[model samples]
Each structure stands twice: as structure tokens, then as C-alpha cells.
Target: MGDAATPLADTRRWLERAVIGLNLCPFAKSVHVKGQVHYALSEAQDAQEVLEDFTRELEALVALPAPERDTTLLVIPRGMEDFLGFNDLVARAERIVRKRRLEGVIQVASFHPRFVFAGEAEDDVTNYSNRAPYPTLHLLREESMDRAVAAFPDAAAIYEVNMETLRRLGLEGWTALDVGPHA
Candidate 1:
């Protein structure tokens, strides 16, 4: 892959620029890449349901794109242990993607509530409801972030592309693309 540092920096820079250009708040979160399972436990019934829905959506995402399937997925769990469902979902996704011989990549991660931001503009965090925009931004654990940087230094740039693509399409941009059907 490209230099790890380059991609990581690119992702971070892209996110930073997007936040500014889109008038989005910082959201106080760090992004990273790694191979691990993350789960969140929540008491809210809605949170639990949304977590399941997120997993299904994630599975379908990885299955899309027929050729040159290089893609990264950011998975946000409902709560701790919610990753259990995520793991199952990933297995199913792997089967589908592999069966189609799609050239893509899938990376799963989770975000803490602290990393989420809500508001109409970038500076405000008022409207921040984790459920609306996305269930989670999925963070790479502290240790994993370090390793991900080591492995894919250029992840930052790649991540920028992801954020830019999202912005261009607008919120729920993936839905507009009909990557599958909206959850």
C-alpha cells in the first residue's frame, strides 16, 4: 500500500478541511485504521436496534463495487459488546464480497460518544445526535491507531477522499449513490 504516514495524514487533513469547508464542528474524535473488533453496550432500546441496523448496512456496503474493490468501512456500534453483532455481520459481508470477486477492502471501527458532534454548522455541536448522522465514527484504539499509522501512513489522505466524497454527495451521501438501499 502507499506510505502509512501519507494516508493517515491525508485522512486527518481531509477531515479537517471538510469540517472547515462544510462548516462542521471538530467532533472531538481521532480516526485510525487497524484489525480488531469493537463493541459498545447501551441501555437504550433504540440504541440497540440502531446498532443492529448499522451492522446490516455495513455488511451491504462491503459487498458493493464489483471491480478494483479497495474500500475502507468505518463501523459504529451502538455500545460495548455490540461488536458481537458486528463480527457476525462482517463474516457475512466477507462471504458476499469474496463470492463476487470484488476488489475492495473493509475496515471496522467504533467511536466514543465524546468524538461525536452535532449542529448545523461546523462550530456548533448542538444538534449532535449520534443516531442521525451515523451511529458511530468508529475509532481505532489508541494502540491500533499507532499500528495503523505504521502500516498505512498515507491513510490520512485516503480518509480525506472518503470525507470529501461524503461531502460532495451531502449527508447520507452513500445513500444517494444507492451503494445499496438506505438503512
Candidate 2:
């Protein structure tokens, strides 16, 4: 497996490239519609601090004027939360969005680590034949992207995955469940 530190960054860069390459023209119209990364807090004490930072950054981003009429806000979550905590956060965010009148603009996405192998053939060729097993890299699902994009109509969502890992998996269109952008 690749070093943890660089993998995430590398994944993010690849995602940026993929989005650009897709040429989803509508998303490109608004300056406010951009990707963001967030890490989950490890402790209750850290929540406030994390929230404060998020709020500040979000406020600043929202304040900026967009050349287009539509704007999309993407929120990426980094940690696990109990059902209660998750509901609470969602409720609070909903309230905040309503209060700010930002519905249909702001989108929240949660990402967890996942292993993606290249399709069976590649795995057989590389991992089976090689002395060492092939590495499984973290990947986000297209379902997660769909959910995020649906929540925020003006936004597009994507999960971060290692390109190398995907190449190894040999996954093709429809193999990964609707690989294209959400309609």
C-alpha cells in the first residue's frame, strides 16, 4: 500500500483532474462550486474547534459572488459517527441551510476508507503471479457521489480513489455501478 500521507493527496489530485476532464460545463460556471476536504474530529472537545473552522471557511466561501446564478457547496466528512450524532449533525446543517436560505446549493458528502482492487484479471496477473500481493487502496463509491450531488443540485460529488488501484482492478463502465455523473 502507498504511504498514507501522500495517498490522500494523490487521490484528491486525481479527482480534480477527472472532474476537469469530464468537462461538466455547468459546474464550471460558478466560482463557489468547488471541492473541499475535511477531517473528522477524534474527540468531543475537538468538535467545537472543527465546527468553528468549518463555519469560518464556509462563510467566507459563501460570501464570494458567483458569476453564474447557481452555486454548489460540497462538504466532505472524515470520521465515523453514531446514528444519533449523525442525525444531530444533519438536523443542524439543515436548519443552518434553511436559516441561510442555501437549500439546493450546499451539499454534504461523507467518505470512509475502502479497498478497491482492479478487476479479477488484473489482480490475477499482478497479485497472483507476483511474490507480494497487490495493494488495496482506499476508494469512495459512486453512490456517495450521487447522494452528494443530489443533495446539492448545483454541485458534483466524487470519491477519492487511487488511479493505480482502479487500473489494477480492471473495472470498466457499469462494473462499478453507474460510473458516470449523476443526472
Question: What are the lDDT figures for the candidates, one per model?
Answer: 0.36, 0.34
Off by over 4 Å in 2: 1-11, 17-45, 67-91, 114-183
Give the alpha carbon lDDT tens digit for every residue of 1-183 in model 1: 233233233334333344333433222223312222222322223444544554555455445442222223233322433434534544554454455453234333432223334334542233222212223333222333445456764655654554454556564642332221122
lDDT of 2: 0.34
Question: After TM-score superposition, what is the CA distance of residue 115 in candidate 1 from its true location, in Å?
Answer: 8.9
Report the lDDT of model 1 for residue 104: 38
Q: Which candidate tops lDDT?
A: 1
RMSD of each: 14.7, 12.1
lDDT string, candidate 2, 1-183, tens digits: 233334334333333443333332223322223433231222222335434544554455456443222232222233322323443554554555557665555544322222113454432322211111111111122343455457665552222222333345443521342222221
Clashing pairs in model 2, backbone N/Cα/C closer than 3 A: 117-169, 118-168, 118-169, 118-170, 119-169, 119-170
Q: What is the lDDT of candidate 1?
A: 0.36
